[model samples]
Target: MAEKKIDKARRNFLFGAVRRFKNEDPDQIEASTAECVDLIKQANALYVDGDFEAARDAYRDCLKSDQNDADIRYRLGVCQYRVGKYRQAKLEFERTLRIDRTYQDAFLYLGLTLVRLGKPEKAPALWSQYFNIKAVVVQRELNLQIGLLENGESDPADTIAEAVEKAIEQAGSAVG
Candidate 1:
């Protein structure tokens, strides 16, 4: 009889919780999402305008609402970097990459942050990965240009080979 009473109470509590959840206003949820989007947009504008401190604050506000947003974390890191908070920026960037490993920009910034933190030796491997991805993108663009040229399109001022060579030079300079 005690077991039956406990089970009944447990089921009643769950049903009550579900009923309360289902009773939430859809408009409230939509408003919350829209507010988050607006905050992110405002933060991005502030960052672009070079107001790093303000942008960082706005990003923090957004993060309060959505802790798992990797892009927000990355932008916050960038703001921290601009403000000379290298150690904090490093942590944020690392967190961003942890949340989204395919975030190439975070990797590049994290490496740059390491360099600024006086750990230059650790940056090369990160930069190498960044440059490899860059090279692949450049190669794709070069192939498109070559294809256009082969089909009798006007030759661009700089050939695909020249672009590839320049990318290699820049990569070398970045590493060395």
Candidate 2:
């Protein structure tokens, strides 16, 4: 008799929780959206100003609000890369990719981070993944920039065509 009473109470509690979850406060969601916009604006300003540490902190704050956002995770990874936190950057990029496998930039950045960590062999796979997701024209432009050393893996927004080139060269030598 006592066991049946406990089961009934547990079922009722679960149903109540589900009901509350399905009826979230709309105004609260609106306020969170506005706050997220403000945080993004602040983080973007800090990033554009070349204050990566501050931008990283701001991005982290944004993550607290939306932990599953792949773009925020990618931005945090870029900021970590800029600050020479290669391992942290690598982890963030990995997390970003896990959240959104089709995020081409995360693949590129993860490849670059691998090269920076002296794990060049891992980069080719990631670069290949990036190429698979990227457009041919964009790939050509990025390769051109990297060949010229203009954008060659310099920043998060930049290209990692050099890593791809190096990986190809390494493969050629191994085959030879």
Candidate 3:
């Protein structure tokens, strides 16, 4: 009974906030969303320009308005990654994939996040999924690694495919 009351209170508070937001001028809201998008774009550009903190702030503001936007979420994750916020980036990537399972970029970035988190086995699966969904660059990178292994340029167990699969298993706690 207490739990239900708490839930009801939470819902009421949320609905009140939404109502207040809705009561604002539509033009202002549209402008804000657009500005948020622009901020995200600017953040990406700034990241490319090597300004990580500014990018992070811009992405955060963008997310405040459109939290479910997968692209923005992924970009925010990437910015977090660039700033060495691996855990936060991992969460953002996970959220992005949850919002859009077919989001190849999110999968790829998730793999990269796992790598940063030092769980190598999981990284490879994400890399593989990314290869399958958007195969050109990732596939080429994997194939190149395979070729290197064939030539004995790298350890067999550390071949990109094996490495990725192992990373997945390790991340899943299947490995010690």
Clashes of each: 0, 0, 7
Better of 2 and 3 by TM-score: 2
The sequence of per-residue lDDT tens digits that candidate 2 reaches over residues 38-151 is 777788788767799999999999787667778788988988987999999999999998999988878877877886786654565666666632244445533543444433
TM-score of every candidate: 0.58, 0.61, 0.59
lDDT of 1: 0.65
Candidate 2 lowest-lDDT run of ten: 1-10
lDDT of each residue in 23-93, candidate 1, tens digit only:
95333421133347777778888987879999999999988866667888998998998798989999999
Tens-place lDDT per residue, model 3, 1-176, is 11111233335454666767768532333223543545666776886686877878887887776677777777778778778898999999999989998887677668657755766456556655664423444555555544554465644333453454444334442211
Any runs in candidate 3 off by more than 4 Å, and if so which? 1-32, 132-137, 143-176
Worst 10 residues of 3 by lDDT: 1-10
Superposed by TM-score, candidate 3 places the C-alpha of residue 105 at a distance from the truth, in angstroms, of 1.6
lDDT of each: 0.65, 0.65, 0.62
Compare the candidates by TM-score and give the number of the best one.
2
Candidate 2: give the clashing pairs. Answer: none
| Collision count of model 3 | 7
Of 1 and 3, which scores higher on TM-score? 3
